[model samples]
Target chain A: DVKVTQSSRYLVKRTGEKVFLECVQDMDHENMFWYRQDPGLGLRLIYFSYDVKMKEKGDIPEGYSVSREKKERFSLILESASTNQTSMYLCASSYGELREQYFGPGTRLTVT
Target chain B: AQSVTQLDSQVPVFEEAPVELRCNYSSSVSVYLFWYVQYPNQGLQLLLKYLSGSTLVKGINGFEAEFNKSQTSFHLRKPSVHISDTAEYFCAVRPGSNMLTFGGGTRLMVKP
Candidate 1:
């Protein structure tokens, strides 16, 4: 089974604080994705990496960035956290174009 | 552009009753369909996918979905549901090699 793990299960931060969410996948999948899930909007993609040091902006990428220093690790960074950024963050990985993504336990972030 | 739509925002049903979650998509290119379930406060888990071959795909925990190309829909179904089945379900579509576009999601509530 593919295993994806996140650094934190829950987090709280003040406005304007910078936040980092880490994700690691056991399998050497080439694709990694970050998404923020809201009440009515569902999971909206933030950023994705297809290779180490390569990233692409997804539908909703404002105020967020990503890093893939290693193949197994992907990180999401919020330059300046705000109350609007408070939501569930999910990380997922898959091989190439395969849609069978393996997801890590989400990180519930709260910004006050 | 590819997009996914989940018609029902929430569905409440009694335990051991049949349930169906409707999903629709629009894409100019061929697309892959997937159904994912997210337990409370957890990440999404792949319930099933339709890439090719069979139109009716059976998934874990006695859940199944059929792909209807003419209607451009992939609706998930289960013969009977339990309390454990209560969760948020998301329908996603991947057009070609692009990133997946997810639906708003359907929250299933199973009552005793």
Candidate 2:
């Protein structure tokens, strides 16, 4: 089974603070995605990486960025965290296009 | 572009009763459909997916969904639900791109 693990399950940060959320997948999948889930709005894609050092902005990418320094690791960075940035962050990895993505335990961020 | 819509925002049902969660999508070409369940404070898990062939897809926890091409819908169903089945269900659609568009989600609340 593919196992995706996140660095933190819960986090709290003050406004304007920079935050980093890390995700690692054991299966070495090529595609990695970051999403923020909010009430009623569901999961909205924030960023995705198809290869190391390559990233694409998803539907909601403002105030967020991503880095993929290695094949097994992907990181989400918030340049300046705001209260609006507080939400559940999910990380997913897939081997190829049109394949099912395996998700890591989400990180619930609280920006106060 | 593709989009998904979950008709019901929340469905409350008694334990051991049958339940159906409606999901509809709009796409101009062929697409893949998926149903994912998110337990409390956890990441999303793939329940099932419809890529091709058989329209009826069975997934974990005794859940199933049928893909209706004509109606452009993939609705999840369970013969009988347990309290453990209570969670937030998301319907996603993958068009020709590598990214997936998720629905607003439906919260399933199972009662005793």
Report the lDDT tens digits of candidate 1 across residue range B59-96: 99999999999999999999999999999999999887
Which lDDT tens digits does candidate 2 get at residues A48-93?
Answer: 9999999999999999989999999999999999999999999999
DockQ of each: 0.79, 0.83
Record all residue pairs in model 2 with backbone atoms less than 3 Å apart, i.e. clashing.
none
lDDT of 2 by residue, B25-93 (tens): 999999999999999877899999999899999999999999999999999999999999999999999
Q: Alpha-carbon error at B79 in model 1, in Å? A: 1.2
Superposed by TM-score, candidate 2 places the C-alpha of residue A31 at a distance from the truth, in angstroms, of 0.7
Tell me the tens digit of each residue's lDDT in model 1 across A15-77. 999999999999999999999898867889999999999999999999998999999999999
Q: Which candidate number maximizes DockQ?
A: 2
lDDT of 1 at B5: 91
- lDDT, candidate 2, at A26: 95
Q: Candidate 1: what lDDT? A: 0.94
The TM-score of candidate 2 is 0.97
Residue pairs whose backbone atoms clash in candidate 1: none
Candidate 2 chain A, run of 10 with poorest lDDT: A95-104
State candidate 1's DockQ: 0.79
